[model samples]
Target: MEQAIVIRSEIRKCMQEEGFTLGGFSKATEIRGSYLSLLLNHDPHKYPLPMRHFDSMIQALGKPEGWLYECYVDECFITGKTDRRRVEPFLLRCAELGKTECIERVLSRLMENLNQLSLVFEIAEKVHAAGNQQGAVPFYECVAEHEKHQHSETLAISQYRLFRAALGQDLHKNRFAATRFAPFRKRLPVEYQLDGLLQLANTYYTLSDWRRLGECADELIALAKVVYQEQHQRKTSKREKTPLNTERHLVLYYGKGYLSKATAYEKQGLYAESKKCIEGYADLSWFEGLDEVGKKEVQMFQIFAVANSYTLEILMGHSYVLSEYTNYLSMHKHEILSGLATILESANKYGFSVDETLEMLSKEILEFKQREDLPGLGWRLRFHYYLSIYFLGKGKIAECIENTLQSLDLSVIINNSGAFAQAVALFELCRGQATDAHLNNYKGLLEEVRKRERFNLGFHNY
Candidate 1:
């Protein structure tokens, strides 16, 4: 009698996990509960119910098949009157089961398919809301990426709406603030080209690939100038001028050209030309009118100019300090002291010391030490460092070690990051050790140097 009666029950596991019963799933998926109950429980292989009903039930459970299978009474799973099935059910099932590996794999593949993106962004927003900014950035990036075959007029129109919605999301994303594609920049033809150029230039800068930086900067400046001139002409005929903010940025762009020019010259060992280009870097009156944000930005740029000036001088094999060579040393105590320190270091490291170079360096160092007047000049002023190093070259290890320790101490007191960092950077680079043991000792010394006065705002002390 049990076999004779046709027993029926809907397979409700996937539906229940979606927070639904058969009827609830029906309402969500727009399928009648009775029909869903029939479809889930039925052996479709035998009775062969409607394919749309099967798809609706799957969709109600938040499933997405690759393509809907168009199956009639008798059709193959692959080639029947149907689409290729996506089988998103396995992923949802894995997620419900809390199988982490399965969830990661499923999500990875799902993100790759651009069609499954809206849900991806929704999931990312949830993750971000749950305080996983690092995790959310990649998902946001994936959502913003264009589908290879799907970008057309309809998609272009929808992109702005989606991007705005993504930006408006209430979630924690600060850690991902610098991530690529999280905010989704405009992809207008003009914007798209700008993006490409920006990327090209950034790659060169990050890698310190000067040749490429020069090439890209040359191209970008040409393009930007032409476009800017056209816009300038158009605005001249307009009733009102371009906004003040826009005007400031246009000026800043010119400054960037100068910066790029300076960098090129510096790399080419044309130190004077580089210094000339960057000398008036912060004297822009445009900075005086800047709002808080703009002022902060200009300040950072000035800091960079100072840092670049120091680097160029170091690379040029010249002691602008102690060697009547630098106009900058004529202006400030800081430049004079720092330049003398660097030149002393160079004389000791490289055998480029003229008799006067060593004599003048020691006198300057001793004079600065006796005065003990500079706030951050403690380690820098201690020890007639060049003579000490010259003695080291003549195998005076005890005196060399003593002078080294004094310089290291001064590095700590003044918070002179460049001096501290370069000491370590150079020790690693220099291979002229008396023995393997001594080499290891110097390496250990580098490791023990404590960095104080921490600030990531970058340094202004050139």
Candidate 2:
């Protein structure tokens, strides 16, 4: 109360010094004079001056954004109770202005009563829905921190949102996030569970954690099947279908379940098991309730099945498929990087020649090398590393060192520790053959890694 009164006094003093009456200030700021008078008088019976009006007053007075925000925190409460009408917009404005301290102050007060968790969660959802994902973090964090129920759906949703918002290019951080959110995956609403499991699977895929990836994929498949069956029943019975607000088509989840399982098995060298899983989604023409979007997903799965079938055969030491695979790649330009990586891996493993394939896709390879934000960065890294290995095996030291350096640089950017280690090992093995330029590039990449490590450490410490 005292802080609110003092802040109101400061506002009145500013208005008086600026030689503006309530009507004059209201005319300038377009706020109602009665509201301005009520605010200046610190009327205890009414609510605090809304943040929008406060911001307007600030702009009219030529004060900077977020001026007096700290003191305004007191105004959000009346007689030891939060005024949601006043506080909601205030917190949003604080977020917009990067006023972390002010937001913390308001949240601290709001969390004193555990009943405010829903309000905080709603605000967080609103912020997230508005595309201010980073801004919603504090609110979600607060609710996650204060909620007393361990198995509450609200808590699970908050964890899920945090997991999603935390994801980025950092593999280590992504792994940690996946671990943190794994337990809550089943506790989320079915809709959220589908998306959460998919994201978890993807994160594990990137981290090369095949075992966990298989686990999430299995869960996703099971849940998606049950829901898909129910959806089919609803359609047949003419009942209102329960909305499944998943990020992708429902069939995509079902297809990905099998696809990801195949990938996990392939990674483990279980070619036979991977081939069976590929057949799971090979022809989903019988899948029920497919709209245009679902039909598109089915078509995509068909494409993947064909490509992956070829991949499985190649990986299983059938070098005869190389020509057909290259032809497929020529038809599907989008699949070139991943397809080439698979070809190189097979070539190195089976001692087959991909020189023709490489020459054929030289233009695409050069474009992939130059582009940084391609969808499959890990594939790019693998392609470069494997290409380097092929060059080394053929005794092309110069080309080998160049590809090694390219792979090393990408490994650092993607934070793929395994790829980084492999690239580093390959470079060391051929250090004697490296030209001066290669040595300099290697030194620069090492420095970049060092700086990145230092930054990560500092961020964690802070």
Candidate 3:
């Protein structure tokens, strides 16, 4: 068999195991960076890859003496001098809905990264079995909780969610994903597990498990209180009369517990109770610098908290807190027209319309798209989400669909979980499924807010 031109999976694994980047490897082996990149990406052409470079790669990757031996009996020639007759582009085919052929090809190739491959297989099986998002969450949560990289973990959740929510798969089942993730949950460090447990609790809440949510919220608050008391006293943070450390600890802890209670009450239609909780949560903390950037972020989130209060009001035409926030947003934030802008416009917070929202969003999209690509691509994700909403409100479902797809795409690249969640949720709403799973997600979403609250109380005994 011709030596594998670019066993990309092997190549990537080798690099990862060696703990070396392409640039570092090139420098160490005296190979040109350009040549190394081609090898990593598995360029089909590119002059058949110099033998010297391959030898250097083997040495750098600490390959055994069997370096030049047959690794794959079959080769997937995606392009450039590949064994096209023998191998196939399984991933692409899998996405194209040819799973049988894809599975056959995968089995034939025997791709070694069985962990991720297993996730894919599991996704397909569950999608077939239970037929919705709830079934897949367990598997996805298992994968997500252990993923070292936050982005990958978030992405796996996103992909599974989008696929399930898109096709109304939420109709199949609705239950807590905690048990599914329980096996691997303990494997994570305590801190990491706490963070994930908070999320898991939140997820269950969104699924509408109020009882479980209470338990989760209490646990989170208790944990936060412990972390807090261990750090500093609450008197300083809450009273603003004690040590600076104390004040900050109180603010964060109290904020955590209050926020969760607020969200939970809001979901229960306890409007006054929810608002009170949120108000308590948003109290001026000893931390949170009041700089323009800091104030802007806080105010934006605070607005969302209040907006939750307004949601029931708006649907019932009872009241609206958006007007003041609108003034603040227009005066303090004419430039940040992404999700909030859309939500504002949709709520007519600034007396804007669907048309105005579209115009504002279109402009913002190009502006952010023009900015240097970087991590935390918040603006990009927001623009896409709002654009979808704008289209949907205009009665252009097709355009709405297009915008949603765009939002999902940008959201993934930027890893904006909230924006991604919104778009995915809205997409389900539009599909007319908005089934039990969608409702369940709303419940889960509420727990996320409450977990933060529990963390503040110093202990969730209350």
lDDT of 3 by residue, 211-277 (tens): 5665566665676566556445544466454322222223343345556666666556677766676
List candidate 2 stretches off by more than 4 Å. 1-21, 41-47, 369-375, 454-462
List pairs with backbone clashes in candidate 2.
Answer: none
lDDT at 105, model 3: 44
Candidate closer to the true structure by TM-score (higher is better), 2 or 3 = 2
* Residue 78 C-alpha lDDT in model 2: 64
My TM-score estimates for the predictions, one after another, are 0.40, 0.93, 0.37
Stretches of candidate 1 exceeding 4 Å from the true structure:
1-21, 24-195, 239-253, 279-295, 317-462
- Order of all candidates by TM-score, from best down to worst? 2, 1, 3
Output the lDDT of residue 134, model 2: 84
> Relative to the true structure, how large is the alpha-carbon lDDT of every model?
0.47, 0.85, 0.48
